[model samples]
Target: MTILIPSYEPDQRLIGLIHKLKEVSGDPILIVDDGSGDDYRGIFDTAKNAGCTVLTHRTNQGKGRALKTGFDYVREHGIKDDIVCADSDGQHLPGDILKITEAIRRHRNHIVLGSRQFTGKVPLRSRIGNSATRMVYAMATGKPVQDTQTGLRGYSSEMLDWLCQVQGDRFEYEMNMLLEAPKAGYDLYEVPIETVYLDDNKSSHFRPLADSAKVYFPFLKFCASSGFAAVLDFALLFLLQWMFGSLFLSVIGARLCSSIFNYTVNRKIVFAGRAQTTARTSIPKYFSLAVAIVLLNYGLLHLFHVNVGIPLFGSKLITEISLFLLSFWVQLKLIFKSA
Candidate 1:
């Protein structure tokens, strides 16, 4: 198996990691100098002298781009081995790296993740950031991935082309991999690894606010679109009911208008379904779902407001909130699945 390390403005710890990796496996190790500049040339030279294939970028590109560069090189050189990608900041232990490689060897069809259990003595930022990201990832994809931000991962050689095509340039690229894995017909396997943090992870290049926004952008966009559509649906339903004095007609009219808007925004913006999905297939499925939801929603509204003597506004609020999560899952898993 080949080991790929993406580095930018790294310190001597990188050289140390390279040496440790050499001891374990003599397979070719590729390191991408992500625009470390002239000052860091000596370090790259030392790594090269120690037997590593180094690729250089004129300026700093993100980690994702650097990884793609390494992948492209591996493909061009005709290396058919599975690749183990690890961070250069000394956070990933040599043993854990070997474990990930071994896992990939055994589970050749699966993506192996070197997962860390953030149990003891973790930094505040690391803890909070990982916790928030983990929650969002689970909610968005319905997958319980313990460590969404782990950098040590193993991929089969067959996945090189797909990895190169995954979206994002920086940290968000990693998140996209997990989010898109199911849709791409890949299963994930997590191997437990030791957690190591040095100087509160100061070597990390991740920008918390900016990168976090990118990582969670897909889920956030869905919420925004759904919220707006729900508001419109409620207003239209209330107005139509007040004018026509017929609940069924009001519900149908409001849903017809609101579902059209929701479907368009969700297909084009939220899930990016237009590129991979055709309206011919998704529209019929979406409207079928809309019809089911309309019936269920009206039934619940009638039961809560008319039978249970609750306020109509309260009934609507409760019913919508109850179905919100279900709607998101169905849309993501079934209707707007990646092509």
Candidate 2:
């Protein structure tokens, strides 16, 4: 197995980790210096002297780009060995790295993750951040992943190209890899590992607002599209009901208008279906889903408004919020799914 570590503004700890790794395994270790500057040159030089193949980026790109650079080198040189990607921030243990590497051997096509239980004294942001992302990622993919932000991961040589193609240039890139995996016919396997946060994870370069937004961008975009459609649908429903004095006619007419708008925006933008998915193939499937959602929407609205004694407008709000996740999931897994 080959080990790839991407580093930026690293310190002596990185060199220490490299020396310890030398004791753990004799596998070739590749390090990508993500614009760590001349100040960190001593550390990189020490690492190079320790027999690591060092790759440098002129300026800081991001962790995702740094990882891709390492993977590209492996591919360009025709290295057939499986790769284990670990963090240089001293968070990932050498033993855990070997564990993920072994898991990759057993399941070549699966992306093996070294999952942390987050036991003992853990940093507050690390705990809360992992929990939030774990929940959202589970809902988005319909699968539970223990550590959504772990850097100790393993992949077979065959996955180099696909790994390079997955989106995101920073922290979000890792999340995109998980989101895009199932669509590409790959599954994940997690191996339990020790969770060590040195100095309360101060070495981490994660940006809370920017990177989190990118990680959750897929769902956020869907919400934006849904929010627009919901507003239009709500307005149209009330107007039609006032004019025609019939609930069913108003519901159907409003849905007809909103679904067209929703489908157009969703198909062209949000979800950006697989390359082969064209308007010719997507339209019928999309309408079929929209028709089903309309029926369900009406049922829920009637149940809340008539049976449950809520007012029409209030019922509309409740019903829309209730069906939001299902609608997004259906559109994601069926209509605009990547195949």
Highest TM-score model number: 2
Candidate 2 achieves a global lDDT of 0.89
Distance (Å) between predicted and true CA of 75, model 1?
Answer: 0.5
lDDT measured at residue 299 in model 2 versus the true structure, 0 to 100: 99
Give per-residue lDDT, candidate 1, residue 318: 92
Candidate 2 residue pairs that clash: none
Model 2, 1-339: lDDT tens digits are: 899999999978888889888998999999999999999999999999999999999999999999999999999999998899999998898888889878998998999989999999999988988999998788878899999999999998889999999887889989989988997878999999999999988888998888888888888888999889989999999999999999999999998899889888888888774424777888898888766777989999989999999999999998887678777877777677776
The stretch of ten residues in a row with the least summed lDDT in candidate 2 is 271-280
Task: Give the per-residue lDDT digits (tens) of candidate 1, residues 217-318.
Answer: 987888899889889999999999999999999998997898899999999999884237789989988888877887889999999999999999999999
The CA lDDT of each predicted structure is 0.89, 0.89
- Please give the RMSD to the true structure for each candidate, in Å: 3.9, 3.4
Kindly give the number of clashing pairs for every candidate: 0, 0
Can you list the residue pairs that collide in candidate 1? none
Off by over 4 Å in 2: 234-254, 275-281, 294-322
